[model samples]
Structures are given as C-alpha cells and as structure tokens.
Target: MGNTESVVVQKRLTRFRPEERPVIEGVFDRLQGGAGGPSGAPGKTPAGKTLTLEMLQSSMGSLAPDSMVRRIYQCMCRIDPGMAAPAASGKTSTPTASGVGREQLVIFLADTMRGTAEERAPLVLAMSQHGAGAAAVVTCEQVAEFLQDLISAVVQILVHRGRLQAWKPEKMGDGSLGVKLLAEQMCSELKPSDQGACDVSCLEDWIFRVSQVSLYLEMLVAEGLNVSLSSRLAPTLLPPCRETPWKELRCLLDLPVLMFLAPQLPDSYNAPWRLVFSTQLHGESFTRVVTGLTNCGPTLLLIKDTKGHVFGGFASHAWEVKPQFQGDSRCFLFTVFPRLRVYTATGYNQHFMYLNHSQQTMPNGLGMGGQHGYFGLWLDSEFGRGHSRARPKCTTYGSPQLSGEEDFTLDSMEVWAVGKPPEPEEGEEGQGKRSVLHMDPEVQAIMEMTGKTLHSQGFREPEEDQE
Candidate 1:
C-alpha cells in the first residue's frame, strides 16, 4: 500500500468503530507480511504491501476451503484491477491474479459487511464466475455451484465454531442434500437469459429481490474469515436452544434448512427453538400430534411426503382444535424441497389455519389456507394421508400445491416451537404455575441488584418455590 492508498484506506476505515478499525487494519498488515504467519507461527515474512492468494488462504485458517478463498481473492481483484499482479498479455485468464493491495482488502470487507445490495452484487458476480476466463455471463449451474460452496462454508463455520446450539448433525437428515436444495432454490430467483446464462443485471436483480443472498454472503464473510463485527452489524445467525434432550432427537430439518428458515420467523431473533412434536419420537398417531401441538405457541410444521417433497406451514398462534378458522395473517405456507419459497396471506380470505378431529359432522383434519377439500395443505385425520391442493392458488396465502402430489402420503413430520411460549393462562398448571422469580432468574438478579425486597423468597412455600 502506497501513501496515497494508505490515506484512502484510512479514510474508509473511519466507517468502522475506532476499536474495530485496528482489527481490519491488522488483517491487512498480517496479509501484507507484517509480523507472524497466518496461524501466529513465527516464520520469515514476504516483502510486499500486497496480499497474495496463498496468504489469504492461510489467513482464512483450515475452516475455509480453497474454492471459497479463491473466490474472495477474485472478488478483491475485480474491486481494484490495479491490485492484481500483472498477467500475460493477450491470453484468456482467470482472475487468479497473484495478489491484491490494502485498498482492495478494506473495500471488500466494507462492501460485504456494510454496503447495500447494489454494492455487493458485483462481488457476487465476480465470485460466481469461478475460473471462467473473460466470461461476461455466468450460467445458472455456475451460480448454483457458487452458492453451494458459499453455504458449505457457512455450515463448516457453524460446526467448526461449535455454534450449532446443541443440534447434533448425526441425528438429522442428509445435510448436504439440504445444502444443495437451498442453493438451487436461491438460484431460482435469478432471471437468466435464453442461454441459461445470468449477466450482472440478473444477479443484481436477484440480490435486490432475495434478501437471503446478502445475508448468506455476509455470514460467510463474517464467520468464514473470522472477522469480528458489532452485534448490530452481525445479529445471531442461529437462535439459542432451550434445554431439551437434543441427543435423542431425530429431526426432518437439517442445519441448512434451519439456517434458511430461522431468520424468516418474525420477532424470533433471540428466541430458543423448542421441539414440540415429532412423529418419529412421539409415534405415528394424530392424537399424539395434536397433544404435542396445542397451546405450544407459534410453531413450524415440517412434512416430508412419500414422494420426497419437503414442505410445511408456519402457524402463528397456538393451534386450537376447532372447526372454525383460527389464526391471523401471520400464518403462511412454505416449501423446503424442490424449492424453498414462502407464501404469506393475501388477505383475500381468512382461511389461515384449521384443526379438528373426532367430529362426525364437520371435516376432521388439519388444514392451512384455501377452502375445504381444496386446501393449500391438509393432513387427514387418518394420520397418513394429506393433500396440498390449489386450483390456481390458495385464496388466503396464494400458494401453489405444497406437497408433491395433490393428495400425498406422509413420510415423516416434525413441529418446532419457535420463540418463547405464550404467557401462562390464569390458574394454569406446570410451567404456567411458576412465578416470575422461578421462571426467569434474570428478574430475581435485577431485583437483588436494585435492593428490592425478596417477598416471594420469604413467603412462598419451599415446594412452590422449587417448582
């Protein structure tokens, strides 16, 4: 980095906090042969103010693979052509430039972490090019491959950092398939040309349309590169888990699906995911499913059809076993396999959620969206048969048929209670009967800190307190 570039980089560094600026600069210095090796091992340093691809890969640690690191370097070179080591003249070339400078590194970090969709779109395009030489457009296959690598990096980061929140990978379904499906689903958002090639405009449009693209990229950069960011800049990617027997659990959802769906839930940023029901554990009975689902708060119901389609719905409120429609517009229909897309209420009708059983006159089943016999998702009281029917689309949610078949056979299902359970009703038992001091120790700690009277501690019976 020359004096001119140094001044420019420092000016841009002001965008970060005073304390954080040094960390970003430290990465630049380390890559430019400052003091120690990538892993802090003492070694002879190279002489240059530039970051070679080797240095970038070494600095990225063992978590990130060569593919991701190469993309990062290519994106950096695209950001500043001057930083790229001189290439042979007149030959088609990969942006496998020898190195990039301090300015390019700083800008890459800034755009990935803080810039808007437009600013990051070019980086995505550059990365998606892979090893294509002088290719002006990227095919859909290329983009999907890029996203697969990107998502793979996110998963590795989560696993390597022990950030799974007690989720055991072995207890779940094939996560690699989930990763591939998610990548394809993300790629579906792009409007490619007749040749199935996506230009920069198509990519920019995708980045603007799908908010998840930016989020995944931001997570990859922040986590894969081990960058420290403020809480506001980098919110928790996965929700914490309430104490549950995670080891014994078998789930239909893998980490990739969880990563895709967790951020979509409203107001659940810090909420813990609680397992409410699973056919595998609780048995294949509708009564058991209902028993597990009722009054368990907002839940995500995932179902895999016999034909291998994974889809479900988000019930915004506690499911009451009644014939009448129950739930507001917050409820929605979503698909996980084949493609991942969410359909919210259109307000065309109030047919959001319905659940009933053991009734002779009324239809006894669980359904969400659309009308009777033409529901967007309907699970029969028979326990194994369900249908996701839509003539054109569901009146309420405007969603297409969710299951693989109009009437599909159930393969497996699970319900996850997201966010905190609704407050206990008056005179309710079990968890509801517990007092605030018992339920939340944070409240008790605050009272003690403020020198408040511990009346509950003194007056409450020992058994009640313990409960």
Candidate 2:
C-alpha cells in the first residue's frame, strides 16, 4: 500500500509543476462554495474528493478552444477522478450578443492584418457573418489608388538601387546617352506643382524628346559616325539655304528630320549635302512634282491615294519622268507616319508626315508659315497616352458591421508587377497552365476554417481590413 501511494504521488506531481499551483488553487477558490464554512473548504468535502474537484475545474479552464475537442477527455482523467467517461466531445457555447464599437472594429482589423493567414481567416468570416463584410464597405477605386502608390514606391526603390537598365553607349551611341541622361536629370529636378492626383502629362513630353534623341543617335551609330565629332559639327552642317523654298518644303513635310538636323547644319552654303528634284507629267498633262534630298542613302518616295493605292516609285536616278494614271483630278498630298514596325539593326525609324490642301480651313490645318507644317520634325511618341490596361474596380468600407454578407476583408493593400507566364512544356500531355487570378487551394482552406472559428466567438469583422 505504501509503494502504491508513492507511485500515485509521483504521478500527481508530474501532472503539474510547482509554479502552476497558484493557478489551480485560484480555480478551486472560484468553484467551491464562496469563502464560507464547510461548503468552501477543500478538507470538508464528502468522500474527501475536494482535490479531484479542484483539478477538474482547473483542467476545464486550461483547455484551449482552438485545440481538438477530443483532447478534453484525456484532461478529465486527472480532474474527475471517479468519472468513467469523458465530457461532451464538442466546442464551447458561443458568446452572447454584444455589439462591437467602431474603434474596436478598427483595432480588430489592424490585428487581423498583422496576423497569419490562418488567424485572419476567422476574423474575415466573422465580418462576413455580421453583414459588415468586405464587399459591402470597401471601394475598388480606393484599392486601385493604393495599388498605384505601392507600385510607384517599388519603382522608386528599384531606380534608387540602380537595378534598372540604362542607355548603353555602345548600343545606343553617344547622342542617345546624352539625350537619355538629360531627360533623366530633368525628371529628377521637376517638382509637381500640385499635390493632387498623379499627373503623368509632364513625363510624356520628356519621353518624346528622349525618343527623338535616341533615334538620331541610333541613325548615326548605324552609319558608324563618331557622336562626339558629329555633335560638334552639327551646327555647321546646315547652310543659309534654310530659307530656300525646297528646304522649307522639306521641313514642312518632315518635322522630326528638321529638329534632328537643326544642330548639324553648317553656317554657310557649302552645299556638301546633295539636293535632287524630279517632276513627272501625268495623263491629264498635270505635273506631279517630287523634291527631296538625303545625306544618308537613296530615299524611297511612295505616293498613295485616299484608298491606300500606291503610284510612286523609288528615285534611283535624278531625272524627269512621266507616269500614267486613270483617276480623276483629285488633290494629292504628301504625308508621313511612323512605321508600325521597329528596325533595330538599320536604326531606320518609320515616321509619317502629311500635307492636305483640301483641309486648309480645318481646325488643324497645314501651311508653310504655321506650326502645323513641321509635323514630322516635331512628332513625338511621348506626347500621347502610354501603354496601360484598365484596372478592375473594388469596394470600400467606412465602418465594420455584424451582418453576414461578403466573402472576405482586406486590411492592407499590396501591388506587384505582372510576371511573365511560365513556358509551355515541350512534350507533356493533359497538363494545364496555372492562372494568376486564383488563390492557392491551401490558403483558401485555412481562411475558411479561421472564419468559422471567429464567427463562433461573436466578433464582428473588423473595419480597417476592408479593401
């Protein structure tokens, strides 16, 4: 009997450490008959089972609701000494209805945002149950703005670190480098006049100038021209003949060419650059005059009608020629537009310019004296809207609610660049590609479970977590 008693004492000692004694004693004090006589003292209990009663009370309080409920059966073994079966295998009763305040909702949302995916799920679920779910409150516009700010911050960080690619002198030439550097510096120095919304209009102009400079540099690089010398000699290349009729006409037709060649023209009329002209007599005895010159190579002149019908040929030799045409006497205009395709090897850009005598009275008309004539020379890629897609809309919330309505809630917003899709397999069969839109299955499951638990706790979804 002594040996058996010793074993029992050892087991009881192993069940709880000395530090846990106060907690056990506290639970017993709360459960026993309030501080009064026989009913309160442990020693006066019937069958001398006060120790067992105290253990049971402590055990129930210690069992975490998050853990599997079945474990409570094992805990009861030490608490209820004479019990043959375990307590009910289920969750505790839900909390009573008590409305959470707005400040409390916000705090809850902040906490949820900091929590793990598992911890957050229940909070989201509770919010949904309370009708103050994410969908009912948060707005898509707010989400978009948040995303934009996030992206801008990330881009700024990357640019500061110098991880982004810069213009390569060897590949883009000295002229290109100078232009790009100037643009970058200008952008860095310019401060927005207003702190309203993000305005990218100023950046558009900078982009156009950069494109022009880059194209010019690329052309020189293709011809193996030394940019340093070319830049120095730019002003001296053009002659005083800039006032000449033909020169003016060419400038009107191609504005970009004029801007690009302006710095390279010579002060005097050395006429180092060749000039050529050709006129063809058509079937109606009308003269189709073509006048242009190029320092690079042979220029291909193509004249097309309103119906996209071509009628011109390449001028290999400078000689007067005649052509035949069956069309009526229609006003034919010479115009140019940038080629849709890019030629990196030749550094030849497809640019367009147009002249329409018929639309002389239109709001945007063409003339020799007006600014419209130099269209091609001033044509820039940056002046218009850049490439971008429309973003989807989202909802917003001003406060948290307790009505069952939405699927989820968000506390903080994050934006990420779209990455390249994975390459397709060469030989795999019956395999499907993954989509960027959907969340992972494991994440969904965890969120679902979290929501259920939070709902049971009678907590409404937090407000700050709404998108």
Number of the top lDDT candidate: 1
What's the true lDDT of residue 255 in model 2?
A: 20
What TM-score does structure 2 among the candidates reach? 0.17
| Root-mean-square deviation per candidate | 8.2, 34.1
Clashing pairs in 1: none
Q: What is the C-alpha lDDT of each candidate?
A: 0.76, 0.23
lDDT of 2 by residue, 1-467 (tens): 24543343334333344564333323333333332332445333333123232322333222212121112112222111111111122321121222222122222222222223332222222221212111212222322222222222222222333433221112211332222333333233323335422122332233234343223222222121111221222222112221122322221112222223323222221322222222221111111111122111222233222232212112222221221111111111111212111111111221122223223353221111112322211111111111101122011101121111111121111010111112335663213332221226565467677763312111111122431
Clashes of 2: 43
lDDT of 1 by residue, 1-467 (tens): 67766665666677788878877766676555523555465335455456667677766656666788888887776665333211222233445544566677787887787777766776787787756343567789988988988888888778888888877778877889988988988887899999898876788789989887888788777765567855435545676665455666777888888887887788643456777667776668888788767756788899999999999999888899988999998899999888888899999999999999999988999999998888999999999999999888989999998888899999999888775566666677555545699878999999999999764342221243321
Q: Which stretches of candidate 2 lie above 4 Å from their native place?
A: 1-243, 246-252, 258-304, 307-314, 320-335, 338-467
Candidate 1 runs further than 4 Å off: 1-11, 32-39, 42-45, 81-97, 193-195, 229-234, 268-270, 429-467
Residue 195 shift from truth in candidate 2, angstroms: 30
